[model samples]
Target: MAIQRILAEETVSVTEMRKHPTDFFTDHPIAILNKNQTAGYMVGKELFETMVDLIRQLQPQESFTATFQPSVTHLKAVTKGSAEFLVKANKEELGDFVE
Candidate 1:
């Protein structure tokens, strides 16, 4: 379910991207696409890093566990393999990673 939501959000963003003609970036559609993709990728990676840091600091002495709704424009949860957190949205709910 969570994955579906995330994908849906990504789809919506892509749809919006389609609506906006690639003419603003000096009429370079390819450049605009590449820039958007890079921006999204970097933002997701940065968010994951920040969350990991926060969890380490706030729960340094114990195992960290929590579910949060991020203010992400498109991407959804990025788990470091936790089996205890269950995210629900579309029709799928997965347990934390079990190792």
Candidate 2:
């Protein structure tokens, strides 16, 4: 038998999820299971967006430029001499597109 980690506080079987999809979502992350094994997570829209924002913040500043500013586009350092310019964006206005 193999042990698996459950990342979410709630667990929902695939069968139950299929039977009632909306019942599983409650603005919190839920672990989706298949045959007692972990399959994936059922995350609400708000939670998903929050996760994305956290990921962006956790990214190494020296490695790559941040991608949030409208005027400044951040690109990956492709070549040895490739460079990146970062423009500050309002962290409060996450999940919103730039004008």
User: lDDT for every model?
Assistant: 0.39, 0.76
The candidate that achieves the highest TM-score relative to the unseen native structure: 2
Range of the 10 consecutive residues with the lowest summed lDDT in candidate 2: 78-87
Off by over 4 Å in 2: 62-99
Candidate 1 residues lying further than 4 Å off, grouped into runs, are 1-14, 17-42, 64-99
> Clashing residue pairs in candidate 1, if any?
1-92, 82-96, 82-97, 83-96, 83-97
Query: On residues 1-99, what C-alpha lDDT tens digit does candidate 2 reach at each position?
Result: 778999989999999999988877668889999999989988877888998889889988776755765432333333322322113435563346544
Scored by Cα lDDT, where does model 2 land? 0.76
Per-model clash counts, in order, read 5, 0
Candidate 1, residue 81: CA error in Å? 26
Candidate 1: tens digits of C-alpha lDDT, residues 27-89: 111222232342231123445577669878887576746686566543333452232254332
